[model samples]
Target: MNFAAAVSVALNALRVNALRSFLAMLGVIIGVGSVIVMISISQGAKAAVDAQISALGANSLQLRPGSSFRGGVRGGSGSATPLSDEDVEALRETVPYVIAAAGIIQQRGLTAVVDGVNWSTEVAGTHPDYFIVRDWDIVEGRAFTVPELDGAARVAVIGRTVANELFPAGGAIGASLRISGVPLEVAGILAERGQSSWGQDQDDVIFVPATTMRNRLGGLSTAGVRNPVQSIWLGIDRARNMEAATEEITDLMRVRRNIRIGGTDDFAVVNFAEFLRARNETESQLGLLLAATAVISLVVGGIGIMNIMLVSVTERTREIGLRLAIGAKQADIRNQFLIEAVVLCVAGGLVGMACGAIGALVVESMGQFPVSIEPMIAFVAIGAAAGVGILFGFYPAHRASRLNPIDALRYE
Candidate 1:
């Protein structure tokens, strides 16, 4: 028989025993469905991590004071050797790879009141370069100009959360808001910045000029310093320059702080590029684990298919004998059985994909986890299903073709 005729006969045979055919496909259905759901969730998690890495800015470094030691007792990180504006100026002048540096000081649990509405949030004080170093964009109005920072102007920039709370009617810019009973004009509004990897709300704070915050609002500062700052954010010119820039920064800080050679660093420098690399490695490991599980599932499903095909050959022994007696080629008989197995798996795969898509949506809606279904994922699942059918169906098809025709016909 021709290939098309063989497929037609195979399909008709499966239709006659529809219940048995469906049972034979059950394993593949479950296996493919599980694989699809797992891949979607894994992809979504990796994507989220990647986005956070991007949000951290290119070649960025966070600088904070190291621990304090008093009476042989050590304090927490960033509790000693307070960073100051002078350090920021020194880095800008001395470090060749440094593109931007911004000193920041923060105050927490401050209530901001506009009209009768009140919202409690943190306030950050920094230079105009703060926006540049952090890669944060101002959606409306402008950042702290040089004059504004130098003069300690009473102007502010609000985040998305702060904007919504203080100005629900949508006119936040150029509005007057009071923090700690000090009235300030809203100069700008920041773009939405969702949440941090550590679960902090990025869009729930307010920003003001460092001088204004320090002089007017009593922001955190180093005692006895002319221009004190809590921490510094440095943006490097390029990613490849991170290591060299870090070494330069350390040397400069040590010299400025009067620390001897081999002494512990008084200030900590955190390289966000290295942190991003570590996160990428973690994502790769997770992908491999998920792939291994998918392979095991496909194998188990293939074994089930092989077992069913063997039973099918045994049940149709008389039919096979009659076909051989009628002068059918051995290849023709093998092709028919092989086609039947493939058809079963492919059909099961389509149903499995539908179930997997629905399952992904349900998971996302329940807020348990995020899911992403790409075209490549579905293509791979379907291709694997077809492959399973071919690999497992071959042995049974060969056995059916090799049956003894005359002896079988007489026995029947």
Candidate 2:
């Protein structure tokens, strides 16, 4: 018989056992759906991580004081070395690739009060260049001007979370909020940044001038150094190699800090470029693992198809013998069974695609990790199902084609 005739016969046979055919396709449906959902999750997670990295700024480097050792006891990271405004200036002057730099002093557990509403948050004091280094944008009002930084003005830029809690009625700009009993005018409101890669809420802080924080907010240096800071953030020139720039900054800092040659450096430089690469690599590995698991599920589904096809061959033995006796070729019998398996799998694949798309939508709507479903995802799933049908259906088809007409007739 021709291929079309074989397909028609196979389909007719499946219709005669509709319930059994559907049951046999169940595994394929599940496998395809799993493949789509897993892929969407992996892609979505990757996109989120990339966005967080971007928010951290391009070619950004964060310099913090390293641990200090005293009396054979090691202090926590950033506790030993006290950074200062002078160090920030020296780095900006010495490092040719440093495009922007800022000195920072940070304090946590501060309460902000406006009218009767109060909210607890952290605050940071930094130079205006911090906005450039951190890639932070001012959505309302403006950042600190040069005069504001130099005069230690009591002006503030609040993040989205603080804005929402304190100024639910809007008009946060030009409004007054008191922190640590110090009243400050809100000069700007920061654009929303959802979360950092480390799971910290990025949009839950307040920003003020570096001088204001040191003189007014109570983050003074223990070493009595003038204009001391907790950390220094630098934005490197995009065209320069980040590692080279980092090395130059480290050398400059060591010299400026009076650390002798061969002595352990008392500072740490965090290269954001390297951080992004590491995060991407980790995400890629996770995606590969998820893909492998989905593939295993598809294989298991194929095995199910194989078992059902074997049962089908046995149950239709008398029918097969009658066809063979009526001058049906062995090749025709094999093609008929193969077509049936493919049709069943293809049908299941179409349904699975719809289910997977719905599942993706549901996940996104639930505010879980983002999900991305591409057109290629559907194509891959459908192709995988067809391939599974062929791989598993071959053995049963071959067995049916090899049966002797007389023996098959007598067995039934």
Candidate 3:
């Protein structure tokens, strides 16, 4: 038979046992569907992490106090070597790559009351530059004036979460809210920023000048350092490498904070770029593991296809003998069965793609998980299914082609 005739016969044969063909295709369907869904979700997670990192700033570094060891037990960041206000000023002055910097003093457990509504929230104090460094914008009212920041003025900028809870009404500008028994006027309202990568709500806090936090809200940690801070944030020049910027900052901090060359540095210098790279690497490894599992499913499905093809060969032995008794060649029988298996798997793959797409959408809608499907991945999955058919269909086709004409024709 010609190639076209072989294909026609193969398709007809599959149609003859439609239910069995579908059962044989089930493995490929599941394999392809699962892989696509897993990959889409993985890509979506990576994209979210990248966005959160970018939202931090284009050229930003976060410096927190490093570990403090008390009798071999280590205290984590901000436990020792608190970031003094002078250290924050030194980075801006000493590092040319540093464009803007600010120290943050954050205090929790502050109850904000306005218009008979009370909400527990975080209160942070930072310089005017904190907003600039973070690229934060005020949607209502105005930012703190230089005088307001310096004076530790009783003025506040609130986040969207705080706004909705406290005011409830549309007008929050110029409204007065009291925090910790101290009254402050609403100077500005921050635009809605979404959650962090760590899943913390970004718009659930309030902002005041750095001086105000130290003096009025959260008390000073030490009497010696009048305006100590929890951490220092800086926006470095994007053109400069993060490592170089870190080094410069470190050298300056070592001298200012009085650290010897051999001793460990008392601070933590973190670049978002480094954190992002590590996170991507970790996620990629996880993706690879998932891919491996999906591949195993495909392998299992291929085995199923092979088993069904073997049974098909046995049931068609007499038919093969009859064809051989006629003008059919060995290659013709092999080609017919091979094409049948491939067509079965390819159809299964197509259906799997549709099912997988639906599954991903359902998951996204119901679970709020991110899923981003790429066109190329779908094509790849379909192609993989076809390949599985060819690989597993070979031996069965070979066995059918080798059947003895005399024996097969005499057998039931």
Tens-digit lDDT track of model 2 for 158-197 = 9999999999999999999998888999999999998877
Candidate 2 has what TM-score?
Answer: 0.85
- Estimate candidate 2's alpha-carbon lDDT, on a 0 to 1 scale: 0.88
- TM-scores for every candidate against the unseen true structure: 0.93, 0.85, 0.83
- Looking at model 3, residue 3 earns an lDDT score of 81
Taking all chains together, the TM-score of candidate 3 against the true structure is 0.83
Candidate 3 lDDT over 169-252, as tens digits, reads 768888899888788899999988888877889999999888887778765577466578888999987735677988898888
Model 1, range 1-412, lDDT digits (tens) per residue? Answer: 7888988999999999999889888888877877888888878777776778767876789888998766678889877878888999999899999999999898889999999899999999998888888889999998878899999999999999999999999989899999888899999999888998888999999999999898889887466776788889999999889999999999999999888887777688998757866886787578668767876887788888889889888888888889999998899889989998898888878877888778778888987766788888778778888999999999999988998997656654
Arrange candidates by TM-score, descending: 1, 2, 3
Candidates in order have lDDT scores of 0.86, 0.88, 0.85
Which is superior by lDDT, 1 or 2?
2
Q: How many backbone clashes does candidate 3 have?
A: 0
RMSD of each: 2.1, 3.3, 3.6
Q: Report the Cα lDDT for candidate 1.
A: 0.86
